[model samples]
Target chain A: MSTDSNPITTEAEEKKEEVYEAEHVHKVYDIIAPHFSATRYKPWPIVERFLREMPAGSVGLDVGCGNGKYLGVNPSLFMIGTDRSRGLASIANHEFKHEAHVADALDLPHPPGRFDFAISIAVIHHFSSPERRVQAVRSILATLRTDKENPGRALIYVWALEQKNSRRGWDENSPQDVFVPWVLQKGNKSKQPKEKSQKQAKNLVETEVKATASPSGDSAQTRAACEPEEEKKEAEPNPVYNRYYHLYKQGELGADAVEAGGKVIEAGYEKDNHWAIIIPA
Target chain B: MKLLTANFITCSVKSCQSVTPALSFRDAELAREEIDFSPLFLRNILPRIDWPLLQRTAKELGFPALPETKPELSPIAEGDEEGVGSEEEQKLLKELHSLLLETSVQSGKLVCANCGHEYPISQGIANFLLPNHLV
Candidate 1:
């Protein structure tokens, strides 16, 4: 991958990555939050079990809790969820009545070493650089409690590169950095793209998809599956917002946790995602 | 955001880490929404609550002043785990539930003591994403 051969080291490169992510990841989620949230009501079984097992009244953080689906899983536990997108955070607060806020993962608003536990599900993969990914993990680990007898833990999950059985067909050999498309079907009054002309939006999506798909052969299939078929009446194409994802290879999630000064208690692949339970070192 | 949630939040800016009572409420609009009362949950969470901070928050939000010291509940006996405690304990737990989980800040600004960065709360959701300079 280009990121491997040309590592992001300079300040300018870091700033560029931030801008890139803002456009590809943050803005895309904001545009698709309602539609995205409609399909995200189900809590993954492992995450539900993890939340249920925590002692009642344990206070925890949910870093990048999109739509706050997991926040209300355990009524006894008090969990404050933060998401980068204001749109998703608002849904979390309004629809779910969960305590959620808009906050970036790297610059969280919580006190360090105070929370009893934290969960970052499918969040860190949005970081465009390896260093930023590790830094994001470090920021999350900082919020956990450090007591020896009952140390706070974090549960993190990221999309796995080795998901051959999945529909996307990404494997270990596929380029880790790629743009995943999110097609916003027309006529969804709430999910319309804001402040962009149709031509401009189409050009932006084409350029991004072309630039990022050179290494991956199945990009077309990915886009085809994302676009819904019910929009045949609309003359213009559905606005496809490409999201950047750094698909993790096997063991990388645990490695990132260790690099961020955490000890991996348990790690495994579950349903095309790599998840780990980690604690402060 | 709940009155209870404010105790856990601090200024997002890195330099404001040492500021005591990390955030203060400004023009907060309060609402009382009834939720299920759970005494066992309150007993379990009491150890983690910052009494002084909670007191300060309660005062700022114009609620009745909290007790100077954190309340202590007797240990749960083997068979009485699910039973609500004696009348006194039940009263305390109900008060706490009304204050912490039921009373929510519907809209306001959370001002940092050190940096003076105001995180606006709208529709009961606080926006803690800082500007580029702070990041």
Candidate 2:
């Protein structure tokens, strides 16, 4: 809610704005749960590698674990995944059979030093302010099980304001605070024969494909291959869910973790995502 | 919905860790167990386990046999190396594994000791979302 025109002023006011923004972000996810989960099937290789390397039966926590994609990386590890969206949590529990709970990222349910390892993927960027993003990271830090022998580590990923394959402009003056759109399927049926509607729907789907073409040829190929035989038949106005995001600049995430009393072990970029490995201080 | 792990849950109302501290499970239902019992896994997990909290949780759940102090990890187990263990160690491992992995609270409410905020576990998933006023 802290727009460019009316900038946030007082600390208390900023905090209040952040709470409203957080609620809005959660609402967006709650609305787009199905659409979001459909496209988020693959696990990022970096996250999979981290989970795979963990000791067997070691307890791990996944904050904002959307669809629980990385929760079942290793069967031996006891992973507890949490997300704000109940729909996504139910999908994770019922479809994937993963252990997940409906919980907030900032105010987590667990105590201090509760988990041996933790992760928050594509989560922090959703916060409207840098301070709330840092607070979210601190929440993860509070749950880490750091001790002498076992120094708990966490991996966090945020969408970078600077992206290589950004179709959307990544100008220096580009607002880090912006709304990204998620186009949903048109639900209402038209007054036409079933076969003709299917053909028209196919044409609309093709038009959609052309309009939203990505820079990557791989995506184009995948989309083209998966097009036919699908029921894209509805003829209705596509709903666009505009979700808020505060994309982090390079080094921004690492600095925030450090500010939250965490030591950055490694910091680097993976595609449009900037990630860091940190041990809670 | 299946119970994952109640080992890490705590009362956040005023940072309360007092008497009746940290919500305890009572008359709960155990629903799911995905991981197989391994003596090595249990031994490796010993140090990470919050002994006092788990013991308190177990007592509240109507299983009062967990020792006051954590049992020593047998040297012969070589759990970190993923080595199998002897029969004697397996018996001990079974007991620990049952307490940690097997027993899961499917449905219950977690009442805070100090402020008395009831965190309900429905559909095998606990809702830990506190209201704005509470925060």
**In terms of lDDT, which candidate is strongest?**
1
- Residue A32, model 2, lDDT: 67
**Highest-DockQ candidate:** 1
Which tens-of-lDDT digit does each residue in A186-279 have in candidate 2? 4422222355554454343322111221112233332322232234543444665555567688889989999999999988889788999999
For each candidate in turn, the interface RMSD (Å) is 1.0, 2.7
User: Relative to the unseen true structure, what is the C-alpha lDDT of residue B68 in candidate 2, on a scale of 0 to 100?
Assistant: 68
Clashes (backbone N, CA, C under 3 Å), per candidate, total: 0, 0
Name the regions of candidate 1 deviating beyond 4 angstroms: A1-9, A187-236, B77-83
Residue-wise C-alpha lDDT for candidate 2, range B45-104, written one tens digit per residue: 777677777777777777756776877755763444654566666777787777777666
DockQ score of candidate 1? 0.72
The candidate maximizing TM-score is: 1
User: What docking tier does model 2 reach?
Assistant: acceptable
